[model samples]
Structures are given as structure tokens and as C-alpha cells.
Target: MTESPAHTLFSFGTLMDERVQTALFGRAVPTSPASLAGYTTRPLQITDPAVIAASGLDVHLILERRLGASVEGAVLHLTDRELAAADAYEVDDYTRRRVVLTSGESTWAYLDAKPLRPAERIVVVGDSIAYGRCDPQGGWAARLAAAHIAGNEARRRVFNLAIPGSTLADVSEQTPALLPARRPDTLLVAAGINDSAVPVGAGDGDVRPDPAHVDAGLDSLAATALRHGARLVVAGPTWLDEDRTRDYEGLRFTRARALALRASLRCWCEANHIDYLDMWEPLRGNGGLLADGLHPTAEGHRELYRHVRAVSC
Candidate 1:
């Protein structure tokens, strides 16, 4: 099996913009002409401000036809960083997926698939962030759900059982009630911010529910999800914006505490063969999306949706 470049994109569109290529990759990349079998392309409107500014265009190609013909494009070599940047630039109109070119080359391409027609029963179990509290429109979950529905019109039932201040234990406690056992759902969890909190007086040394206990709870959550015949995924707790958290929300946990908790939660997910998304890295330093450094604002929810798409969809 051949490994794809850390990143690869078969661009039938956008990267065609010189400014977009420059802004997204910092330089023009060498490309080879390629054609993808079984797809058709049409114009897709670009709505993201930054993407519009970078591309200097409001429309790009959207591929819909998936059989009997081909779509001509180019194979672009992108650094992982650049690939992520391109993902951000594409916004939600398109999603990247691997494709095999007629020339026998395998690469990635952006496609606007169909929409919702529920196939998998996906259940999200965790905290307030999962509930999209501060995100005016909807949290990442909502955004991801909409996109999932669009991608194939695949009908999906996503049970969002998120609670404010939910510790891993709280999540474990709620699992049986929210998730169906025999039917089996695709379960996702994002908790631990509550357990990792240092509080105003506790400083950063230790948290309320022991971190070990948090891990134990996470383990239990995964076990229960699997026992009930559901697939499990997790978005580990994100890092905080100290100033925003302190000034706005008045929550004062340190970076060290966040890192420690993230490490613990991530380790548990990896060990259990659970699909995981590291929430902190993507959301960090992003201002407009964060309402108070801790929770996502409306735009933040959209941004989270993008990240969620890359990992889950």
C-alpha cells in the first residue's frame, strides 16, 4: 500500500486561484494533471470571509456526479499544515475525501455530497460544550450533524446528551439512559473539563474528582457504550484562554492542568480503540469563535463543526 503525501488534494477548483494558493500554502505548488473517474463538478458559493479574501472569488467547483465519467483536476502536494489551512479555507461547502485518479494515483478531493437520510444512530454524550451552550447558532455537534445529513442526505439520529459541569462520572451515569442498547448508536464523548477544574481557591495541583477517577469513569463510559453495541468516539477536553476564562467566566485553571487532563483523557481514548478528536489544539488561540475563552460563540460552533468534520466525517 502506498502512503499519501502527509497531505494531498486533487484540486479541480480553488487552488486554481493564485492568491488562494499563496495564502493557503505560502507558495505555488507543482502539480500534475489528473482526472478522477465517476464525478461531476459545478459552481459552489464561497461564504467564509477569510476564504473569500484569500481566493478573491465567491465561487468554486462542487462535484456531484459520481458515476460513468470523470472530473479533471490536479494533484497537489501539501504539507499537513497547508492541508489543514485548505480545509479551513474550503469552509463547509466541501469535504475532503481520498480518491483514486484514472492514472492510478491516489489523492484527496473536495466534494459536496448529498444530505441526510439517517443510517447510523449517533449519540453524543458529554458536557455543555457538546450541548453548544455559548454557540449562538449551534455547537460543533449541530454543524457536524447538518453536514452529515448533507453529505449523503443520510438520515442520522444524533443524541446529544450533554450537561453543564458534567464530569466523566456524570457522563458514565447518564449513558444507559440516553443510549439505546440493542439498536446500537455511534457514541461520542467529550468531558473532563469539569473534573480537571482547579476552582478559584484550589490552585492547579489537584482537581475535585481525582484525574484517575476521571479516567476510570471514561473507561466505564466506553465499556458501557461497547457493551450496548455502540461505537465510541471522544473529543478530549479543550484548553482554555486564561484571560477570557478568568475575566469573563471567572474560571481559573492553569495550562498545566489542562495539559495533564488532556493527556490522561487522550490516553484512555487511544487505549480503548476509541476515535478521538483533540478539541484543545484546534480551538486554541481562535478568538472570534470563543465567547469567553472557554466556550464557543456562534462562529466558534461553526469552526468546531469544521474540525468535527475533518475527524469524524
Candidate 2:
């Protein structure tokens, strides 16, 4: 009989590899998504021949202390014996340290044996589009995050905080809470479609969000990001297939309204000296890119990802 795995290990590096885990523990350990805040990763060159062969790499990720940053990884459950095996596998350039995960779980991890500094972080906040919606791949934001995972030397951490059915007002209310904990180098606000949507059967009273309030919300978000040393980029409203979108979840979207909002948001971004991503033009006349007339399909998300990657770079 074997005792239940009692040790908790958080890994933001090669220990995440199934091959590495099997070599050390004789099996792949159980793990769950988790993140460590106030830390980042840098490349650590490996000289140990055994580690190089075991992990199939001559370089590995090493943690570095950085304020206003976080590293995404997983929490691995291991028995005491397996934990010891992991310790033996790590080289002198790595040091084991007990740390608290963002979920408040206390776990042991291998951090940089030597101290250093540096990094870039991106945070995306918006509506369902930014939240990925119909896309099974988790949309453009997830693609951006995947691009930076593990082996990528340009490693940029992207955090998507968008929610379905969110509006500028909702983002304005939620974004402030992200501060003091996450100070992203770039902040992407991908919203306004919901704001432009007019409620069905409401006649003339069914109006798009007031330009004044929209401007105020944008200004507030920009100020918040700027104060925290982040560059703000606003992704304007996308084009809608009005023919298929006139009735959506008790609301109605029109081509004219979407176009108006896009133009208004673009002008505001320009006047405010903020970067604006013109999501409307590329998506217009392409109803196939939209699912159910609103949210993007998988191919549509890839299209969106290309535009986002351009500005982010």
C-alpha cells in the first residue's frame, strides 16, 4: 500500500513536462491550473548532462521576483518520495522555496537560485468577444497566452478578464479591482458591442449607450491604466451581420449602430492618444466569421488574434 501523495508542488517550468515527471516520479503526477503572483520567469542554461537528456532541453525556465506580475503554472500532487526525487533532479541553479499560489494554496517550487530582474505583462478586459465565446480554442486572448508559454523567448504573459454580456460600465466597475495586484505593461479593452446593442421592442427609447458616458468610461479606464504605468489600447466595436443579428438574446444589433460606435471609439482613441484596434473593418462583410451574428467563430477568432498580436507587439 502507498500513502496518499502528501506534498504539493507548484511548477512554472520544465517539471510541468510529463517526460520530466515520469523520469523522476515513475508516473505523471496529478496537477491543476494555478498561478503564482509577484514572480516571472527567465531562461536558465543547463550544464548537467543528465538533466539535459531527461528533459530533452539544454535550457529551462527559472523564476525571478518581480512586483506587479504573475506566472501561470499548475499545482502538482506528489508523495514524499516523489518530492525527494524532484529535488535530486533539479540543478544547483535552482532553489526550492515555499510559496503561496494565487488560489491561496501553499506549495513548494523551484525558483531562481540566483536573483535577477525583468518582463512584459498584458491584461485583456472586455465583453463576450474578448471572453472567446463560440471559439473552442478560447479565442484570441488564449492564443496570445499560448504564444508565450514555456519555450518562447519573447515570453509575454497575457491575462484575459473579459466576461460574457459585459459592457463598458461593467468593465469600468471591475477593472479597478485588478490594480495593486496586477500592473500590466499593456491593457487591452475589447468592448462596446454590447453597449451599442439596442433592446428589442423598445421602439425609439431603445438607444445605444450615450457617447458622453462611453467617453467617460474610456477616460476612466485609460487613466487607471496610465497611472499604473500601462499603455491602454481600445479595440473598437466589431461589425455585425444585421440581417442575422436583428434579434439576439432579447436585443437587436444593426449595422449602422455598430459602424457608428466604431467610428466614435476610433476618434476617441485617436484624440486621447491611445492605440485603437480597428476590429470593425476586417470583420465587416464576413458573416461567416461570426457565429449566430454576434460572437466570433473559431476562424473568426484567428482573424481577431492576428490583429491583436500586431498591436501587442
Candidate 3:
């Protein structure tokens, strides 16, 4: 029998993000907002940070439509070796299931489902970094994906939906519809700096610190992930240098607050059975790790992958 040609992988998450696409695929991908029917999208909880998902609630199968919608994403035409490499990057907590895409024809695609654990799908949601900013290959979310794939060959798939400037309030607002659609396995949440920096309180236009709001948002995200048989991983914010002296009303980016915020997130993760990754401490020492003051460099990504590999091993 003649061998069939390799199939193309359609994505709608972090892989869709520009930088991440370039890093993993060695170039940009052509994409559109493809929607899968009988599913919904949700905010993913990954310790201290949030991601997004497209899950199915009522049915086991997810029917997708490549509507040519102008969403950001890419199409990767894979060879067996490339597929293997991709699989190596998505092994943990995910299984490669083929789905029928709604492009007026049936197309095989990969879906990340954790049947053994029966956990919620893993979603990585947040701001720019979550969106695979500056250092495409080095973003924590991508690193996590690559690590998971390498460790759990048969079951690792993650959907990363990190928008720039996304906040806790945004997550709270977007979660309901997304959860049922994505049916996530876990949620990885990393957001806050923007919220903290925005001015919105009664005072001399001062920035506010509403840990309660942040906590509530996280709680909801966790609950949603758990509801869909998913776990949670909350990652705290990485260090950023927003001039505190400028007294930027509503935006507070200070080292002290960052540490405290991370602690609070860690406490929440522990109590909720969510995994926690401390990006702040690990990425601090060398300037080599950060592309700018905020994002991770290629070396930084490698370091993160090493840590994740260690954990899995």
C-alpha cells in the first residue's frame, strides 16, 4: 500500500501566537479563526497565571470549522519526523486524537485530552508573555508545552490563549463561555501587572492593589478548570520595571508587590491542588534570560524547559 501524505495541524491557541509559531515551526504560519462546533472557550488556570481553551461539554468529539475568520494563528504542514517532534513537545496530560474539521471536508487534527487523569484541559492565559511576546522560543508557556510533549509522548497537548494586557477581570468575564468549549485539562494563569498599574480608586489617582479581586478571579478560573476535569497551575508575574516613583495611578509594579503577589498565588495553588512555577526567582539572576526587563530570552526558555524536564523526570 502506498503511504499517505502527512496531515496539516490546525491551531487556535499559543501556537497561533506569532513569536511562538516562528520559534517552533522555524517560520510563520498562515491561519484564520477556525471554530469547532459543539464546544466553548474558557480561561485556563496554570498556577498564578491564566490561559484559554476550546472544549466540548456535551459530546466527546469536537467538530471544528475553519471559517477563515481573521484570528491570529498558523498552519503547519508536518512530516512524520516533524509530527514526532511536535508530539515530543506535547506528551504530558494530552492525547493525540483526530478530529473532523469543518472546512466542508473532514480533516485530521490533534486535540489535547487527558483521559487517564480525567482532568480538565490545560490552558495558558495572560498578557503579552502569555501571548508569546519578544522571545518566541523562550516563552514559559511554549517551554511548558515542549517539556510536556517530551515527557509524556502519548498524552501532552496544551492550548495557549494569552492576549496582551489580559487581566483577572477579563478572565472572569471570558471564562464561562470558554470552559465548556475547551474542556481543559489544567489552567495556567499569569497576569496582573496591567491591572495593578491602571488607576481606578478613590485617591490622588493612585494605583490600587486588589488582591481580593485577583484571588476571586483565580478562584473562578480554578473552579472552571476543575469542573471540566482539569487541574490548575498558577504562575506569578515575572519582574517588570514600571517606574514606581512616577506614581502611575492604578499600576503598581514593584519588586515587593511582585514577591508578595507570588506568595499569595502560591498559597492559593497549594490549597487548590494547582501546580505552581515561580518564574520570578528562577529568571532573576542573569540578564541573559530576559529579552527585555519583562520577557524571557532564548536562554531563559531553555532554562525553563530544563526545570520542567526535571520536574517530570
Candidate 4:
């Protein structure tokens, strides 16, 4: 009779949440902050209350383990049944593999890739959504981690460094620090909404679309991603409501500005050979999915995840 592999799951994303951990594993395992070599974290942009833009340019990767530095996360010791359940739930964009984990011990951990495409390095940079915002259950990026694990049982290490309210400019400034550390296989970037929301000049009316800035940021981000031999995935900003009422806080922008930003982003993605995920139309087209006019409620997030899964698949 064949024996089931005894495995330990190392999680760095939303799985770090105690409740989420318990729900997935049926019991909580001891968790600590751990870092993987050759990866950095950043933010994902979100506009509406319910939906967030998968913005920014922060992602985790495999590299040489540093002496002192470590990424933060929890480790779950898994039973065969629990591991099976986890595998079923995460069978999407991720695949599992073996990695020399933070504990300095080698055990069976879920790495996020098929055959674990070995890269000298890789980076994912974005805003709050990338960082995982209000969705306490660990946001989309966390889910992506799980998917990576389930998909590639051979290599399950992807670094996540998503921060909230991060702009493209922030990515440009930080890319150098991350690129210097490791060479990545894939670089995914999500940005835009914040640029649209920022008030223009001294007065509110001065707020306008800065195509020049957006263009410059994209150029730098794409060059950096390609320089690292990474495939770039650029996600457009999620949809937001322009009309504000006593019920919700909405960005007040003209239709022209909104359309222009969308067009500009689409154009840039196309020109750069970056894989673009258009989250705006799907979220806006579906009303019940959004909790408040902006962010994705639980249901909305699920929808967004579905979208990512489809594209990733």
C-alpha cells in the first residue's frame, strides 16, 4: 500500500489570518513571519467600497535565504484529509513544489507553479488589493497563493507584498530595490485608480487625468519586468461610481476623465505585451456584487477571483 505524504503548509498571504487558517485546516497551526529570497511586496489599488483594483507592483519569489531577513507568515501542519480539502479548494492558478522554507528545515511545502518554473527571481507589485485589504478572509492574492499551491504540488513559494493606496509612481521608485535582489520569471502589476482619485491642483477642480505620468510609470514598470525576464500582467482599475449620495462616498470625476483613463490604460497594456485583466466592465456590469459602490463585497471578491482564475487558466 502506498503511503500519503506527510506535509506542512507554509502560508505568507491571507492564510495568516487566524480564523482563515482555522477554517482551512480545521485547527490552527503555529505561524511566524517568514521571508523568501528574491521577492518584494507592494500595494493594490481599490476605488469603490466593495471592489479594489489589483494595483501596484509587489510580489514574492524564490531566492537565496538572507541571514537576518524573513517574510512574515504562519505554518500549518496538515493531516491527509485537511491537505486534501486544501488541495481541492486551491486547484487553480497555483501549483505545488518543494522549497527550502523559512524554518531552515526541508519538508513538503506547496510551491506555486507547475513543475515550479525555476526563476533566478520574480516580483508582483500592486496596491491594497495586492496587499489584501478589507476582505478579512485574506484577499484575492491570498487565494492566488492557495491556487498556486494546489496547482503545482512541486513548488509552492510566491512572495506577496501588496500595500494599500499605492500608486504607479511608488512602483517606479521601489522597483530598483526589488530588481537588484533577484531575477523574476513573472512580474504582475495593477495600478491606476489612485491616480484618478488624487485631487489635481490646490483646488479640487484641478484634478485631471495625467496621461504623461501614467505612461511614464508603465514604461518603467514594463522595462523592469522584462529586464528580469518576467511576464507582465497589468490589471486595469476596478470600476467606481461617480455619483455620490448621502449613502456612500464616491469619486467625483467627469465621464470624459474616466473614459480617458480606461482607454489610456488599455493602450499601454497592449503596447507593452503585458497581459491585461479588465476588471472594470465585469464589476460595473454586475450591480449586486459590490457592497458599497466601490469595493467588492464578499460576493464581489468571489466574482473578481473567478475572473482572475479564468484569465490565469
Among all candidates shown, the one with the greatest lDDT = 2
Ranking by TM-score: 2, 1, 4, 3
Q: Estimate, for each residue in 1-313, the C-alpha lDDT of model 4 and write its tens digit.
A: 6344366666665455566556666566555555443333332232332111111213323222222344555566666877676665442334443344444643334343322233222356777656556577666666766666565555444566655677789877786577656445556676666666633322355344788999998888876654543455677776655542112134333334555677788887766535567767667756566544555666666667677766653
The RMSD of every model to the true structure, in order and in angstroms, is 11.5, 17.2, 17.9, 17.8
Off by over 4 Å in 3: 1-121, 150-155, 198-208, 241-252
TM-score of each: 0.58, 0.60, 0.52, 0.55
Cα deviation of 12 in candidate 2 (Å)?
34
After superposing all C-alphas onto the true structure, candidate 4 shows an RMSD in angstroms of 17.8
* Model 3 C-alpha lDDT per residue in residues 70-128, reported as the tens digit of each score: 22223556556556655554424333543333442233344434221222235777777
What are the clash counts of all predictions, listed in order? 18, 0, 68, 69
Off by over 4 Å in 4: 1-122, 179-183, 200-208, 244-256
Better of 1 and 2 by TM-score: 2
TM-score of 3: 0.52
Clashing pairs in 2: none
- Kindly list the per-residue Cα lDDT of model 2 for residues 162-217, writing each as its tens digit: 99988888898889888657667567899888888777976645344588978988
Name the top TM-score candidate: 2
lDDT of each: 0.68, 0.77, 0.54, 0.56
lDDT of 3 at 261: 65
